[model samples]
Target chain A: MSLQDILTTGTAPKRVAAGMGFWKSLFSALDTPVAAPSSVPADDPLAGYGPQAVEITPAIAANQRLILSTRRDIDLQELEALCDAVGWSRRPVRKVRRALDNSFLVVSLWEQLAQQRRLIGFARATSDHAFNATIWDVVINPSFQGQGLGRVLMEYVIAQLQQAEIPNITLFADPHVVDFYRRLGFVLDPEGIKGMFWYPS
Target chain B: MSLQDILTTGTAPKRVAAGMGFWKSLFSALDTPVAAPSSVPADDPLAGYGPQAVEITPAIAANQRLILSTRRDIDLQELEALCDAVGWSRRPVRKVRRALDNSFLVVSLWEQLAQQRRLIGFARATSDHAFNATIWDVVINPSFQGQGLGRVLMEYVIAQLQQAEIPNITLFADPHVVDFYRRLGFVLDPEGIKGMFWYPS
Candidate 1:
């Protein structure tokens, strides 16, 4: 019987074989944790050359510039490497590429030294294009951490969303860096809005 | 000077007119709460006919069916009425329509009574179509509350996402209904995933 028939007639449907346990397994598949550690050590060559450093030798500072771009044509392998540098487990490159392509906007920060540019920070957001947007997978190259680049990247991303008139901004914060977001004016459980999730049995 | 020039040359950019306060105001716009009260009273015609009632009379149940659909072309006015029935503040119909149109999938549940159908529940999800999806604006016409249709609707939505291979599912929940979601195997702060919001300064 159709589900409608079963509902109206109170009759058991033929596909009753897929019971509650089946639904549980479906949710369980969602439980895989995709998280970056709260503390990541600098792991790249430019560790000492972060632009926000208090003191930099004139030669090193003159040629190095940090620039943000909305370019969606991100190099996937490089993104994977950046994620790895910040202690994220390997995510399938194909899935990561699809996520980037489908996102409403992608922002990348580049470190340019002389003629070479390296992808040092990245974040992307998905939005309804009018009402709300949530950022995902925000990461900065470990070599660029603690240099105020995360704040700059976040400021640029929020500015872009506001420019589009998407008024609501949200993100899933790892416990270790909740304060980092709080410093940027992010509130936890604001007006009783709490995040919920479902996982497989 | 361009932002790149400011960064590399240590020169203040001209538009320094809009400072941190401007950014704060942009985030503040997002602080408008779009929440449904955890306790909503029955306010519609089908208050007595929820299909899952153990004592539902045969006469009452014979002609009524609860059906779920993935129709994206939702009637925005009807949706507004249902949201009103559940005590949500009025959302501008134009923005609501845009939100629905931009969603990856929209699910609606209807109460079919022989010759007539009424919209009774609605929810929509946005997804990267591979790794993650977040459900939004879930509402059950208050008249149909406590009869298990909400659970039924959630199961259908989860099944649809699982079939599509979107493995991560999330939603923002009100404090009052945390247990309701937990009963369905949803965990709070799972693996230290906390929801954070950036609001106006």
Candidate 2:
């Protein structure tokens, strides 16, 4: 049988009456994989490309300028000039020093702005590396907001988590950001799953 | 106003509308500081709890007997005898050793079992402290199960976590045991919240 015939033969209905094979063969001829024309263009926004596209790396001191330029890390005095540019209050250098000691902070700096290497976005997670992980403080610089940087940063963080093979990860999001996370594969805890947060004033 | 009216005055429609307010008033009327409930009653079926209630301590060797008796950590010779009793094959000790070191292994027994006299059920977490905590291999031996020991252990762990102040905690449960955790205030991740597990051969 021709390749098309072979492929179509598999699609034929099983248990046909003895005299119906002829009709089945005719119907099967229409079952070719190529029958439907492709509607998506190479650049179609929704096309299934390979894996998600993004570059992510650990944040380093060298990227400080680009990061500070964005003023997202206003709590860090080193970024005070940038924060001033954006009308943010100057933060104490001691406060910045203390916050930097948390090991779980992973800042992603975009290379294109290397000279200005400000922390355009960052994520922080807490883990014991076996069963649980909690993600917090995920944010993208407002200037970088619409460029999909947040999603890219999140995907990168998730990939890192998958590599670590954590069994469960959880996060809380501002109610307004719920839809953004929902699209990124998060679900709301059910009605009864109350979260109690004790913030240090 | 009646106690019920006082309790119901300023509340959500559901809280006020539900008959729960009546029950709340009844409980409030009878509420008073009371003596602690007796530890698991002797006639309780779960009274089989004995050496199993051995508290976990920084030193674990002293409680070896209790540790070894648990289903998750059955004593090998005893297991062999039980296997012989049930006419099953005797497995190599290496099988148990391997199981103890598996990625799914979360609990870590310490140098001795009685030094501090506090039983611990701990799991390594997957991600960082800000987002989630996944509990794995959690158990308080049969003697400890029904006496709120598990809750105590969890509360201890939770308190430690609160110091870091992570926002969310998550865990997976066998389909049948989900409700037990639900009562402790865990809710299922919405549909499609997949939790993956890998077991070494």
Candidate 3:
């Protein structure tokens, strides 16, 4: 298939999966109303689940082992490896470092799926930190595919921002993922935000 | 004249004046062949030599002021003020704030022109902070008109950046100010950087 077909047509399966996952989670919650836990254990590996889960700090040191084991922030030593992962043109390490440092927030979600602490999924946000937030870099590592980790990560991040009382959050979903976000309470902003990108040649 | 006519005909000289002040300050060093100063005291009172100085920070306590000032940070309040000053409509402050915090290095320049610290000018840059910096938001106050302070400020900032040994510093200038930047060693970018603005009511 052509690139346009891949972007527009082949995305249906992912959308169906995301939609079914949203409904299943919603109905499952209604079916079993669990009591809200007062607090989560600091070291509880499963503390990220259910209501009343403890806060996840953004500090790398707080979760350094998880970060390192998941290989989330790998050094971009090779151009081909970097491009294969991010579809970005290869540039100097200095440039890549600068871009990574400038990212507003980079969130990595780890899950022990099939007996491995895998980088199930991740997302990056670009924002001014007070009022506006843009979600980007939503990806699921291929090894950890077919689980509901993407949705879990999304919901977790959304809850984090909501708890912080942030009012306006925005993101540009790949057209295929638009329906996924919509189902998760994001509306199709008719007058959506525009962004400009310049690549080093 | 209508507002559109005024803007198109360039009759609102005050707006132009503020813009010119910023442009002048940023490029002052290039006007003369003399080697520029190595650095200026961040609290240099002479920095506010132009017309529209706004003292966002106190001059006496330079170090403390830098700590307290959100000028370098993505400030929602100041972003609102900027939109108002430029006649743009309001937007979700969070998004703008994020963009500022993540992608831009904002520098707040102030001056004490009349025994009051006023924010006479400001500049934001998209840079690796090592190479390939693009400068934006060089503005000066209109009330503090006719002083050569604007040029001085520009020259000072550029010299500091140049001293860092980064090559390929760039900026986008309005048509009228193209020659101004040109004289300061910035050539016209034939493949201009993409720029867009959104105004929400």
- Residue-level lDDT of model 1, residues B51-108, one tens digit each, is 2111111222556755566777677888989999988999888899888888877878
Worst 10 residues of 2 chain A by lDDT: A14-23
Better of 1 and 2 by DockQ: 1
Local lDDT at A135 for model 3: 59
What would the TM-scores of all predictions be? 0.70, 0.41, 0.43
Model 1: how far residue A43 lies from native, Å: 31
Per-residue lDDT for A61 in model 3?
30
Q: How well is each residue in A93-181 modelled by candidate 1, as lDDT tens digits?
A: 88888888888878887777756878888999987776778888899987767656676667657756765678888888889888988
Candidate 1: C-alpha lDDT: 0.64
Candidate 2: lDDT of A109? 34
- The alpha-carbon deviation from the true structure for residue B63 of candidate 1, after best TM-score superposition, in angstroms, is 0.5
Name the runs in model 3 displaced over 4 angstroms.
A1-104, A111-115, A142-148, A174-176, A187-193, A197-201, B1-104, B108-117, B120-201
lDDT of 3: 0.43
> Model 3: DockQ against the native?
0.10
Q: What tens-digit string does per-residue lDDT give for candidate 3 at A108-169?
A: 55544323444445665444455444555566665434445456556545544443344556
Residues forming the 10-long window of minimal summed lDDT in candidate 3 chain A: A23-32
Per-candidate total of colliding backbone pairs: 7, 34, 29
Classified by CAPRI criteria, candidate 1 counts as acceptable
CAPRI grade of model 2: incorrect
Expressed as tens digits, the lDDT of each residue in B21-103 for candidate 2 is: 11121111112232233665653321222222222222223343221112245344643443354345565576544433332
